[model samples]
Target chain A: MDSRRLFSGSFSLKNIHPSVLITAVFLVAYPSFATDFFIFQIGAYSLILGTIALSLMMLAGYGGMVSLAQLTVAGLAAYLMAILGDNSMGVMGLGWPWWLTVIVSVLGAALFSTFIGAVSVRTEGIYTIMITLAVAVAFFYFVRQNYVLFNGFTGFAGVEPPTLFGVYWRDPVPFYYLSLVVAVGFFAAVSYCARSTFGLGLQAIRDNPRRMRALGYNVTLHRIVAYFFSGIVAGVGGVLLVWFNGRVSPGTVGVDVAIDILVIAVVGGMRHPIGPFLGAIAFVLLENFAIDLIDRERFNMVIGAAFLLVVLFSPDGLLGLWNRVRDRLRFRGNAQLSAERVNKDDPASSGSLEKS
Target chain B: MRNFIERHTFWAIVLLLVVVLFLWMIFAVWPDWLVEAFGRKKTFVNTLLNGVTLGGLYFLVASGFTLIFGLMRNVNLAHGSMYLLGAYIGYEVADRTGNWFLGLAVAFLAVAISGVLLQVLIFRRMANDDLRQTLVTIGISIIAADAMLAIWTGTTYQFSPPDWLFGAADLPIISVIKSSGAAVYIKYPVFRLVVLAIAVAVGIGLWIFLNRTRIGMMIRAGVNDREMLAATGVNVQLVFVLVFAIGAGLAGFAGVIGGTALSVAPGEDIRYLLASLVVVIVGGLGSITGAAVGALIIGLAEQFGLAYFPTYGVVLTFLIMVVVLAVRPQGLMGGRG
Candidate 1:
C-alpha cells in the first residue's frame, strides 16, 4: 500500500491541477486564435521575462541570495550574442554561427554570475543586495562608456534570430513556441531540483548557513554553484530577450530594468517555480494594456501599487493568495477533514496522533 | 594609530605614503617636468577639489542610509526618491519664495515628515522582515518616481543659491607662474566650498551626537542589538523613528545642496542611490566615519578617472569598490556584522 501510494502520489494524472492543465492547453493553442501581436508581444515576451525572473527566484527563494545582477548577467549574454553573432551595429560582430554564439554567451554569463557570487558570498545576508546592486550599476556605466567593446551609447541593433529547419525562429508562432518550450523546461528543471539533494542542502543552508557549515556543508561553494546554475537560466532568457527585441542596448541592462526583474520575481512569488511566470504574465499584460486603462505615465504607479499590496497582504504572491483562498474554502467545507489531513501529512504532528 | 600600523603594516605604510603624496600634490609647487608628466596643475587641483566636494554630497546621502540600516536593518530603496523629492521641492520653494535657505528648511522638514509616515505605516508593520521591507520600499520608489515625473516633467532643475554664494573664490594653491614670474592662485566655486564645509560640520555634529549625547548612545545600542535595547526599556520604536527622520532629512538636505552644485534631473535619484550604495559598501555599513572615507575615495576616483581617462572613468570608481570588497568584505569600518 505504501509503494502504491508512492507511485500514485505526485505524477498521476489525477494529481495534476486542473488549472495548470487548462493553462498548458491554452498556451499550446494560443497562436491558433490569437493575433500575432498577442502571441509574440504578450505571450513570448512574458515567457522570456518569466524565465529571467525564475533565475532570481531560484536564488532568492531557495538559496536566500537576492541578486539584482541577474539582469546584468542576462544583458552580458545578450551583448555577447550580439557581438559574436550577426549585428547591424558594425561594432564587434564577429559573425559567428548562431549555435556557437548562444553556447559561448550562456557560458560567459554563468562564469560572470559565478564570479559575482564568489565576490558577494564573502559577505552575508543583507550585504548581498548592496554588493550585487553595485556590480549591476557598474556594468551599466561601463558598457555605456566603453566604446571599443560595447559600442558605447548606441548599442547593437538588428541582431536577428537564425533561420533553422526551414522555419524563421523570429516568426510569431515559432518564437512563442520557442519561449514556451524554454520556460517550461526551466520550470520543470527548477521543480525537479527543488527536491534534489543539492536543492535540499541549499534550502537547509538558507534556513541556517552557520548550522549547515557546522554540519560540514560547504555553504559558500553551494551558494556560488547556485549562482552559476541561475546564470545559465538567465543567460538563455537573455538570448531569447535580445531575439525578441532584435536589439541590445544599454537600457536593457540599466538599473531600473535590473530592479524590474526583482519586482517581477517578488510580485509573482518567490516560493514556487511557477511564480515568476505568473508574475511575468501579470507584469507584461499590465505594461501593454495599462496605458489604455490609465495615463501612460501612471503605469509604474499602478504596478508599484499592485506590487505594494501584494507584498503587504500576500508575501508569497498570487500563488500564496490562491493557496490561502483554497485553504479557507477547504476549511469552511470540512474543518475536521482538514485537521486530520494535516496530522496525517506532517511527521511532527504524527506523534500526537499516535498518542491519541 | 600604532595599533593599526601593527595590525596592517603594509596598509598603514600605503596610507602614509598616499597622504604624503597627496599633500605634496596639493601644496608643493609642481616643477615644469611634474606639470609636463601629470598635465596642468590647475586641472589636477580642480579635479581633486571636485572629488572632495562630490564626496561631501555623497556622505550626506550615505550617512543617513547607513544610520537607518544600522538601526532598523531596513534597506530603504525609496531613499533615492526622498532625495529627488527634496530637490524638486527645494527648487520650487526657492524659485517661488526666492529664499534658498527656506527651500532647504522646508525640504528637510517635508521629507522628514514623509519618512515618519513611511516608518509608522509600512516599516512598523513588517518588522524583522528585511527582504519584505526592501521590496515594499522598491514599490514605494516606483510609485513615487512616477508620481514625481507626472508633476515635474523631464526638465532639469538647478538651484540659484544666494548671491553671496555665487562665483568662484581664489584658493591659496598656486596653479601657474606668469611670464612676469607672478604666482597665480587657483579659483574654485564658492558654493562647492560651502557644501564641503557643511558636510564637515554635519560629520562633526553626527560624531558628537553619537558619542556625546544620551539619545545618540541609545541609537548606537539599538544598532548593536535592537532586542536588548528594547528590553532595557529604551523605547526602541522611538529610536528607529528618530534615526529614520534624521537619515531621511539628511538625504533631502543633500539633494538641495547637490542640485545647486550639480543639476536636478529625472535620473539623479538613481545616481545618488548608486553613489550611496557604493559609499556604504566601501565605507562600512552604519558607520559615519566609514561613509565619509568611502565617499571621499569614490568621489576622488570618479573625478580623477574622468580627468585622466576619458572613457574608463566609471571603471576607476568600480575598481575601488571591487578591491575594497575583496580585501575587507565587512567594509573598511564595518564591525557589527
Candidate 2:
C-alpha cells in the first residue's frame, strides 16, 4: 500500500476497490438512517477532524516536515469566516457571502502556511517541530489577548452555514453530506497527488535532500508548496468545523487541539491517504462515547494511552497493522519477505525519517 | 534576510542583543502609546527581580530537557507533565506532613521513578526516532495531565514554603533620601530568593558535573555520536537511562518551586513545556550555559511584559522564539541544527 512504481501512468477509478466502494456507500447512506447524535457527533465531527489530520498527514507523510500548526491554520480560517461572513456575535462582521468568505479564508491560510514553512524550511527535524509549535502556541495567546482581531478568549459564537439551494445546510443530513464531500474530495486529491510526478519528486527529496539538490530540484520550494497544500486542506476543514459547531473561539485552535490533530494523524497511519479519516473516526468515537465508561475529565488519559500503544506497536499506525495482518494471512513467508524488501528499498515510502 | 544572518553568525548574534536592549529601553520609557501605570522606579526593580526568579525556575526545567535532547536525541514532551506531577506530589506531601524538605524529596523521587519508566518502557524502543519519541512523550504527557485532573480536580493548587521562609527580604537596589538617612530596599519574597539560590546551585553543580567528570564527558560524547560511543565499549543504554531520569527529575524539582512561587493549575504543564521550549530555542539546545542564558532572557521579557503590557506577556516569549529561530535556527549555543 505504501509503495508505487516511480512513474506509473495508470489512474482509473472504474474498477473501484471494494474497501473504497463500501466506505463511500456507507457515507452516502449514513444521514438517512443514522440518529441525530450519530450524524452530528460521529459523522460530521469525525470528518471535519479527519480532514484536518489529513492535511497534517500530507505534509509530514509526503514532505517529511512534521508541523504542529495545522490546527492554527484551521482556526485562522474559522476566525476569518466569522469576521468576514455575517454572524450573530456582532464582532467585525463584514457581511460577505459564505462562498467568497471561504475562498478568501482558504487562500489566506495557504499564504500563511507558506510563510510559516518558509521561515522553518531551513531547519531540519526537531527545529521544524519546535518552530511550528512555538508559532502555534503564540497564535493561541495572540488570539486570546487581541480582542479587536479575534474577539478575545470568548470568540464568535454564532456562525451558521449559508442556506444555499433553499436547504438550511446546518440540517443534520445536509451538513453530514457536506463534510463527507469535502473530506472525500481532499482524500482523493492527496491519493492522486501521491502518485503524480511532483509527489514522487517530493518523496525523493524527503529521502535525500542532497541528492535531489544535486539533480537540480528546488527542495525548499517543494517543502513550502507541500505546507501550502496542507494549509488549504486544513482551511477547508476549519470552515466546515465552524459550520458544524456554529462558533469559533480561542479554544478551537488551542495547543490541545493542535496536538490532537497530530495524534489523530499518527494513530491513523500517515503512510496512506485514508489513514487520517480512519484515525479521526476512531478518535471521534472515543471522544464521544468513552466518557460513559471512564470519567469525563480523564478522557485525555485514554487518548494518550491509546496513542502511545499505537505508536509503540506500529509506527506505521492502524493501517500498518491491518496490512501486517493481511500479509500474515496470505502466503506467509513470501508476503513477509516482500514486505520487508519494500520497506528496505524505499525508506521515504515507509516514513522512516532521516534528518537532512 | 534570514540566510544573510545565518551566514554571518557573530554579527547577527550581536545585532539580536542590541535590538533586544533597544526594545527594553523603549518599553522602559513607557511612551504615551504604552500603558500608563508604571512610573515608579521601585516597580522596575521588583519586576527585574521577578524576572530573575522566574528565569531561575525556567532554567531548572529546561536544563533537564536540553540535556536529554543532547544525549539521547529524544524530545521529552512529557517534561512539563512531570513538572505538574511534581507540583501535585509536593502539594499532597507538604499538605499532609507539613514538612517542605520531605515534600521536595518525595516529589523528586517519584518523578525520577516515572522518568526511568518512561525511558525504559517508551523512549527506549523508539531509539533515534525523534518524531516517534515526540509522539510517545505527547501521549505520556496527556495521560499524566488527565490523571492529575482526575486526582487533583480542576482547581489550582499551591505548596507554600515553610513559615520561616515566607517573609520578604530587602534587596538594597535603591536608596531613600529621607531626613533620617539613606536606606536601600526592594523587599522580595524570601522563598523566591531561596528558590533562586537553589537554581543557581543546581546550574553550577550541573555545569561542573558535565565538564569535570568522566560520566559527563561520556554524556557529551554520546550527544555528539551515540554510535561512536557505543562502538568504543560504552554502555550507552545506561547513559541514556541516567540522563532521562535526571532530566525528568529536574523538571519535577522545578514543579514544586514554581508551584510555591506561582500556584500549579491544570494547564501549567503545557505552559511550562512551551516556556522551556522557548528557553531552549533562544538559549540554544544542549548546553547548560545556553539554557541559563535563554531562561534569563525569557524571564526578563515575560516579567517586563506582564508588568508593562499585561495582554502581551505570553506573546513576548513566543516573539523571542521566532526572532531567535529566524536569525539562528541552531540557537545561541547549539552547534548543530
Candidate 3:
C-alpha cells in the first residue's frame, strides 16, 4: 500500500511495448485490405479521431487535465485553413498558399490553446474541464456567426486537398496512407516525449504539483508546454479532417464531438500510446457496423450503452482489459512452475505437510 | 485609486468598444425611420418587455442546471434530455387528453419521476467519479435522443395553448400609439404569461427551500464540501440523489415551456444543453442568482442580436462568455467554492 511499492508494482514492460508493436503493425496493414470507401471513410476517419484522442490522453492521463476543448483547437485550425487558404474570396480573405496557411493555422491553434491552458491550468480536475468546455462553446458560437472570417453557419467548402506526387490526394487510398503516415509520426513523437524529462516533469506534476513546485519545477510552464504539444497533435489532425471532409462546418467542433474525443480517449485507455488507436478502431467499427445492425436512429443508444459499460467495467479501457488477460495467463504459468520447484526441493517435507 | 482603476479597466474598455461598434453599425444600416422609432417611448417599453419575457424562459432552464452543479458538482449533461422528454411527453399527453393544462402537469410529473429514477439508479453509482458521471450521462442523453428520434423521427412538434388564451390584449398606454404611425402592438401568449409566473414562483420557492429547510441546508453544505458532510454522518448519497432528481425535474419543466416557445426537435436537446451550460458558466455554477443573471444576459443578447444583428446572433452569446471568463473566471455572481 506504500507509494514506493505501488509505483514499483505498477511498472511493467510486457504490458506496454508488445501492445504498441502490435498496434503499429495493425495500423500499417489496415489500409491494404480495406476497400477504397472503407479506407477513406473508416480508416482515415479513425486515424484523425485517434490522433485527436491521443492529444487528449496526453493531457488527461499524464498531466491530469481533462480538456473538453481539444476538438475546438482542431476546429480552430480547420477554420483558419478555410479562412486563410487560397479559396477564401470574400471579406476577411487572405489568399495565402496552402502550406503557409497550414503552418499558420497550426500555430494559431497552438497559441490559442496556450492561452486557454494558461487560464485553465490554474484549476484542477472538473473545473479545468468546465473551463475548456466553456471555451469550446464560445468558439462554436463564434464560428457559427462570424461569416466574414469563418463563412458563418454554412462553413467553407471546395477545400481541395494538397496534391502530392501527381495524385489528386483526394483518393481514399492515398489519403488513408497520408493519415497513417502522420499518425505514425505523431505516435512516435508523443511516445518519445512521454519518456523524456519534460514528460516526467508533467507526470510529476500530475502526481503532486505542490511537491514538484517545491522541487523547483516550473509547474505552470510545464503545463503550458504540455498543452502546446497536445495542441500541435490536435492541429495536425484538424488539417487532415478538413482535407478528408473537404469542408469545415461549425458542427465539426460542437460540444458533442468535443465529448466524443473524450469518450474515445477514455475507451482506448489513456495510459499508453496505442490506446487511442485501439479506441479509435472500436469506435469506428461500432459506428459503422452498429448502425447497420440497429435502426440508424437508435445507433446512438447502442454507442451510449457501450460507453457506460466500458467506463464502469474497464476504466483503463480496452487496452487495460487486454493487459489484464495477458498478466493472468503469465501468472498461471509462473504459479505452476513455482509449485513444481517446491515439490522437487522437498518431496518428503511436502508429502508430510500434505498429509497433515 | 489603483484598485479602482484595475477593477474598472476591463469594463471600461468593453464599453468603449461596444459604443464605437454600435455607432458604426447604426451608421452602416442608417434608416430615416430610426429617428422616429428611437423617439417613441412605447416602442422602447415594448423592447424592454420582450427582453424580460425571454429572460424568464432562460431562467427556467438554467435554474435546474445551477442547482445540480451547486448540490453535487456533477454536471448533468443529460439535463437537456429531460427537457426534451418533457416537451415530447407534454405533446403526447396534450394530444391524447385535449387539455393543455393537464398535459403540462403530466409532462412535469413524468420528467420529475424520470429524473428521480435516473438519480436513484444510474447517477447514484457514478457520483464518486466526475468523468464517469459525464460519460454515463452523455450515454444516457444519446440513447434518449435516439429513442426520441426513432419514435418521433426528425420532424418538429408544436404545442398550442387553449383557444381562450390565444388572443392579444390592448394596453391603455400603447393604445394612443395605435392611432399614430407608431402602433406599439403587444401580442401576448397566455402560455408565456403562465411560464413567467411559474418561473418566478419556482425561483422564490427554491430560494426558500435552500435557505429555510434542513434538507436544503444539507444540500448547500454538500455543494461546498461533500467530504465534510460525509464526515458529519449525513447520507451524502441520498442528498446527491435528491439534488440530481430536482435538477432534472427543473430542466423538464423548462422543456415544456421552451417547447411551447420553440418547436421540439431531435437535435435541440444538445443545443438547449449548450445554452443552459452557457448560462451556468456566465452566471457562475451552483448559484441560482448567477443562473438568473446569466440567463437574462444571454436572453437579452440573443433577442437583440436576432432582432437587429441576425448575423451576429450566434456569436453574441459566445462573445459574452469569452469576455466574462476573461474578466471574471468565477462568473458574474462568483461560484460558491
Candidate 4:
C-alpha cells in the first residue's frame, strides 16, 4: 500500500526504461534471422512507418492537432531529394551531393510543414484536419501534374540509395538495421522531449489553450515546434522509404497513406511511445496479409474495418487495453493481499470484511 | 483609387496575363516557328480542354463537398469513396440495363441508400466527437473504395454514353464566325452540359430545402446549435442522420456524373476527395454558395492552367487552396459554424 512505489512505477512507464526491453528484444532476435527480404522489406518498412506514425502521435496525442499532411511532408522530402540530387532527370536538377541533397530535402520538408502548421494551428478540432487534408491533396496533385520538378505522373526514378562504409546500404539487412537504429534513436529523442518542460508545456496547452496563454506560454510557438519536430521524423522516414523502394512517386505520398498514418497512431494507442510501433506492426502485417488473401483492390476494406473496430472498441488503442488488463490483475492481487493483512491483524474484522 | 491599379498585386496579375497573351499570339501567328519555340498549340488546346472537362467534374464533386460541410459541420472524408461507389454502381447498372438514364438513376439511389446506412450506423454514433467522426468516416471511405476496387478488379472501365455525347460538339455558335477566320469553336461534351444542369438543379433544390421546408429549418437549427435544437424537441439525431445522408447522396450523384465525364478507375476516389476538400476549404465550410463559388473558381483555374501551363495545372488547385487559406481562413463566404 506504499504510495511511493506506485508513483515510481508510473514514472518508469513514462520514461525510457520500457524501451530498453523493446530494444533488447529487437537487437537480440534480429541478427539470428537469415531472411534478407524479411529483415529489409518487412522489418525496415515497419520501422519507417513507425517513425512517421510516431510523429503523428506527438501531434495528435500531445498537441491535439490531428494532421493528415505528415505523409505529404515525408513525400515532399523524398521528391525533393530525387529532384535536387545528381540522378534527377528533372529540368531544375541541382546535381548536388547526397549529403547536401538530404539536408536540403529535410529542410524543405520542415519549411513546408511550418507553412501548413502556421495556418492549420490557428484552428482547432476537425477544421485543422480539413486544412491539413487540403494541403496534402494540393501537394499530391501538384506533384502528380508538375513534370518539370515532380516528373509528372511517372514521378522521379533512378534515385539511388547512398553507399556508405564500403557497404551496399540498399541491401535489406543493412537497411533493416539502419531503420532499427534510426527508429530507436528517434524514439529515445521523443521520449526525452516528452518528459522535458517543453513537452509538459505542450500537453498543458493541449489541455487548455486559453489557460496556457494566460500562463504566458507561447502556444503557437509550441505547436510550430511540435510540427517541426514531427516533420523531422516524417522527413527521415521518407528518406529511408525512398532508399528502401529505390523510387519516389506521387502515389507514395497520397492522401490515403496520410490517413493511414493517423490510423496507425490511433490504433496503436496514442498514450505511449510504443503505440506507434504496435500500430505500425499491426497495420503493415494486416495490409500485407490482406493483400495476399483478398483481391488487391479489396485490401483496404480490411484496413477500414480494423480502423472502425479499433476506434469504437478502444478509444485509447492497444496500449490502453494492455494497461487496463495489467491494472485489473494488479487490483485483484492487491485485494488478496489486503485480505491476508486483515486476517492477521484482526481475525474478527476478517469475517465482516469478507461479508462487505 | 488611381494608385491602387499600380500596386504589385494588380500589376503582377496584369503582367502575367500579358505574358500569357504574348505566348498565345506567338503560338497562333507563328505556327511552325511556335512549334519549334514551344510545343504544339493544338495539343495545348486539347490538353486545356481536357483540364476544363476534368475541372468541370471536380466542380461537381466539390459542390457536394461544400453542401455536406455547410450543413452538418462534419468533414466526411468518405465523400470521395461515395463518389467512387456511385461510379461503380452506374457502371454496373449501365452494363446491365444498357440505358444511361436508368443507370444513373439506379446509381444515385443506391449511393443514397449507402449514405443513409452510413449515417445511421456510423456517423450517428459520432455526433459529438469530431476527430473520431472523421476517423470513422475515413475508415468507411477506405472500406467503400476497397470494396469497389475489389468488385471492379481495379481495371479502368470506359463508359461512353452516346456517340453525339462522346466528344465535343460543333454548335451553331461556332458557325457564325466561321468566315471571320477566328478559332471560335467551343467543343464540349453533352454529358458535361448535363452535369452543369444537374449541379444547377441541385443547387436550387438545396437552397429551397434550406429556405422553404420544415425539415430544412430543423437542419439549419441543428447546424447552428444541436443542443438548442434538441431542447426545442426537433429530433437532433434524426436531423444529423438526414443531413449526413443528403451529403453522401449528393456525393454519390456527383460521382455518377463525374464517372461518365471522366474515367472511373482505382484511386480516382482519393483524387476527387482531395478536390472536393479543396472546394469546401476555399468556399468555406457549411455554405452552399461558398461551395459553388469555390467549385467554379477551382474549375476555371484547373481549366486555364491546363490550357496554358500544362505542366503546372494540377498544382493550380492546391495553390488556390493555399492562397485562400492564407488570405481568408474562414473561406470566402464565412460559414456560420
Top-scoring candidate (DockQ): 1
Q: lDDT per residue, candidate 2, B271-328, as tens digits?
A: 8988888899899888788999999999999999988887878778877876887899
TM-score-based ranking: 1, 2, 3, 4
Give the alpha carbon lDDT tens digit for every residue of B66-141 in model 1: 9899889889888899999999999999999999999999999889989999999889998887878888898898
Off by more than 4 A, model 2:
A1-14, A332-349, A353-356, B1-38, B175-184
* True-structure RMSD for candidate 1: 3.8
Fraction of native Cα contacts kept in each candidate? 0.76, 0.66, 0.50, 0.69
Write the residue-wise lDDT of candidate 3 on A86-146 in tens digits: 5533545377888899999999988888988987775556667767877787778778877
Give lDDT per model, in order: 0.89, 0.85, 0.77, 0.75
What is the overall TM-score of model 3 with all chains considered together? Answer: 0.84
User: Considering only the true interface residues, what is the Cα RMSD of candidate 4 after superposition?
Assistant: 9.8
Sequence-dependent TM-score of model 1: 0.95
Lowest summed lDDT across 10 adjacent residues in model 3 chain B is found at: B171-180
Q: Which should have the higher lDDT, number 2 or number 4?
A: 2
- Which portions of model 4 show Cα errors greater than 4 Å? A1-19, A22-25, A88-95, A288-297, A335-356, B1-59, B160-187
Tens digit of per-residue lDDT, candidate 1, span A14-97: 666677789889989999999999999999999999999999999988888989999999999999999999899789999999
Reference-based TM-score of each model: 0.95, 0.91, 0.84, 0.84
- Model 4 residue B280 CA deviation in Å: 0.4
Higher-lDDT candidate of 3 and 4: 3
Best by lDDT: 1
